[model samples]
Target: MAGVYDPSVQQLRSLLTLAEELHFGRAAARLYLTQPALSLQISTLERRLGVRLFTRTSRRVEVTPVGRALLPLVRNIVGATDELRDAALSSLAEGGGLRLRVGLTDCATALGATRRVIAGLTTRHPALEIDFRVVDLVEQVTGLATGRIDAAFVYLPVAEDFHIQPLTTEARVACLSSTDPLSQRASVCLADLADRPMVSLTPQVPRAVRDFWSVDPRPDGVPVRYTAHEVSRVESLLSAVSFDGARAFLPAVAAELYPRPDVRYLPVTDLPPCTFAIAWPEADGDAPHLALLADVCRALRDEGLPTDPPAPSPRTDPDASVASLAERQ
Candidate 1:
């Protein structure tokens, strides 16, 4: 490779860190370098690569399309290098067992799929040690990209760099305050909530993912009204609905996992169902451990023991009531 084309591992590491943080100062702090030093490194890398990695303004920083495209490749390179180093050290240690860290969103945990998956993995790989980390929905993609977690059970429509295996598909449901008039309905249509203020995820969540969850632009093409308060966790989101009178749309599994007297989950008759899947770095798809886990998931699905609960049936009339959406579905 030419001299200019040969960027050091540290340079690549800095680029990956900056891409994750999207803030020069914070990325500098994480890398233990001054902001100026980090900027110089990024600029040098871009000059050598002949591509602008990021677009920076006074208030915000955004990665360009090229930067997004390169991010996973850089991450895989760094991850493989680190794994090689770890492997060398593990070889010198006694009775070193392989460990895989799996990430889960709240919905995954609530549905008991993570537990079943872990159990199956343990049975298949007796010596493997599995660790489960609860990650917020918005950060699951970032977690996978940066190798913070080996694989994650997350909602669909992830970036192109991920390999997603469909797990379970469930109906979409709305979370509204019990006192809200819509809550009285057996099932609500997207148009019914058109005028109500909905709770939305923070901007950290990708636009497409957020829009999908928010059920934006009711089938009629007008955007659903959303409150200013953006939540990052399911607990906070439900609390907002219970007390703040804000509505939210989530998977039917959420209704099963979290049953609150103050909130009602009503099926959306028109919106498409949400699909949750196992997402991992596409570069690492062929690794034995990841492959085994994926196999376990597929086996469970084939056996008809999905991690998610069954989707509840929609109510035919507002006056025809049921105990809860979970029971109906």
Candidate 2:
């Protein structure tokens, strides 16, 4: 490249750091280069850029007015360049058609948006291959932490260690078999079904869900009684083949995931709405696919679904509902 505006990133960084530190020795220490080496690099940069970037004396080192003006621009440029390099590395990891593995714990309220994010990422960044996995909340957390998965569809509140981005809120509902008498009602309340045999998430319910159910307080401080989790359980415990009168609390997404002829989903008028987020390891920090997926998720959340989701019933008490009741078990 001919010299009109040709700039070496290394030289620009050295200049920027020297300006920032205002001390040759300190700047060299920060850059892990010797002071003389840094000085030489800075001199070379000034020569190449055809400008005096700094004025130096034994007493002090100072950026010139031109250098000061250029400092902010240089910082932004260098920072952006670093980000670009990281992103390029990330793309290379994704480019070989490796699966951009995506995982979901219990379904969240924003399934529609989640689907759109996947579609958009795949279409916009065709080099990435995406595979979606459905596991429980604990497994999702462990997978992200261990780098076994790139991103997880998580319902808040996730454990503190993982980074999360909110997607959407969903109303909590009670799912039942169409054959059940409660299915005849347009809506159901927790108090109304208090005595009914509930298909409780047998495993420890995720903290967020427990809070939604108000596990600490009951009308009579009565311990909530429900059926335990059973393997091979459909989203709703009730199915044509497994048609047991078990009612489970779920978000709109879960209901949609396992739509069944024999089962009916009814709004729970007594619970608050649940929120969901996309989660990945804090360790993954800013993995590009994760970052891009988060961006795509945000876009999908803002623009909304390509097709309208079912009308959310007004009977639900959004304040108390949880998003992924499947995690409750």
Candidate 3:
């Protein structure tokens, strides 16, 4: 077999550095370039490679197998290049450069541990530059797919083929008005909401929403008059719910994020918990950025609040699964 050298050595160098640093902003700083410039360089490398090297979610980053395999080779090449730099530095007595860029969802409060991970990258790689982009879930996915984004913190229900890195776990809680008669109770059970109207963040499944509110083995199918996607729209949602005397199912963490004077949060006892994972494309290649994001996500996970929301009742069947709810729907 013949040895092949990439003509895009500078591009390759940047990619390898990104893989090592596992973050864009830090890598960019090291390169002495703006974050966008650094991102363009990595994007260019991916374009030439003809294969995707990374996967990202709003919460974290990941490297494909291709990225992993390429990392060591990249390190070796960069090291060799560093030796060349050392020779030049010895002669001229000059410094070098480093940088990195990071992408994330605008919802910073929701990202928990991922924030610390970025800080670590900057501290450990002082020479590196860090750049961050606030993006949405879909945009984050597209970024990883097309190489525009190195890594991100994203929600679940992503492509299965991608390598998923779990950052933390969060269970759902029902957000209700404090003024509601039910809110007077310390906690509320799923069955308690049987006939009550509700608000929801467009459910992954209509059945899932129905199941959450159903007390009977079969759902009575109460109407969800309000649906929303934006977290900021909770005020409007709350207004809608209040008008209808409805309650909404939300992640416990999310519930606390918006503390309405008129509303309170209660866990849906005996419900299955939702786990948020940071996913990346699965392939063998060197991807430094993705790995870096994953580390950050894990750190965020460490700071995560308890996944266990207060149970509706100890006597309630813990065995009750979402599948059971799915069955009725």
Candidate 4:
């Protein structure tokens, strides 16, 4: 009440990004601003607050005591601003358009199925704007629960509270080292993988989901062997399979989608097929739009339509332009 403090929303966002990244270049890249511009924003904000927020050195950036104390408050302000903007946009409908946030789980190999549904929705509702995010195993349902994503194409074993419809099921394949003896065979069973320990998934993943992916407590009732280290992403899992004498279960499509010279995907003969499902919050079960989305998903799969290709991967260059990314995707 004693101080006059007003900082632009972009400045506050820059503060949050810099705090999270702790590096000028990366934070600037994320903000789509030059380093000097970001530094100016931070400095101006600090001037108004009458406190230094960060201690900067050539090699590193450290948050000051005040910065740490202010982070939660800054987060709240930013979150509220975002919520208000979203509400206003919803009311306006941006030219009578509907914006949906769709999530693609890292474990969703049936991406083709999800895309077909998107296409169907687009054909029917030309004004629908689809904003989809690719989330990892850790953030699978977190995105949905937090409202970051309106719906999700996720692997099975999602919480029972959500309305889920199985879209497509594909046989699981064992991702193993190309040099492993079992890789020589056309296919292998769970028993054949006894010596090959499973890669432990991230601790944050739900127990039931992990069990579903790992096929825990083998069909023969044998204890499944898992590696001591845990992996949270596909790249890490691929590295583990390549060098750590570990194996992971992925949908058979991985053989083509993720091709690595040192890794081989052998069909797992004994394990049951893994399924992908389209899930949404239970509250939306009666919503006409969501019902239509689910129907499109089911029809695409049941009708055996040609699979939809995934958007191409964008360039890794930090300076890549938005137009370039759009073209690639």
For residues 155-269, write the lDDT of model 3, one tens digit per residue.
4555555676554445556666656776655556666776565554434333433344322242444443434432224465666565557777654555445655666666566
Give lDDT tens digits, candidate 2, residues 192-213: 6666555654354455654443
Candidate 3, residue 125: Cα displacement in angstroms equals 3.6
Candidate 3, run of 10 with poorest lDDT = 320-329
Error of 1 at 278 (Å): 0.8
What is candidate 4's CA lDDT for residue 233? 79
On a 0 to 100 scale, what is the lDDT of residue 88 in model 4?
Answer: 47
Arranged by TM-score with the best first, the candidates are: 1, 4, 2, 3
Q: For residues 1-329, could you state the per-residue lDDT of candidate 1 as single tens digits?
A: 45758777678888887888899987775564689999999998898889999999999888999999999998898778757644543442224466778888877775455566678777655666788888997678888889889899887778888887765566778888888988877787788888778897888888888888887756789877778877888898999999989999887768767778888888777878877677889999877567666656654643445434455666754433233433121
**Quick one: best TM-score, which candidate?**
1
Show where candidate 4 strays beyond 4 Å.
1-96, 106-110, 286-292, 295-329
**Residue 172 Cα positional deviation in candidate 2, in Å, after optimal superposition:** 1.8
Model-by-model lDDT, in order? Answer: 0.75, 0.64, 0.53, 0.71
The regions of model 3 sitting more than 4 angstroms off are 1-111, 136-148, 197-239, 242-244, 283-285, 294-329
lDDT value for candidate 3?
Answer: 0.53
lDDT of 1 at 69: 97
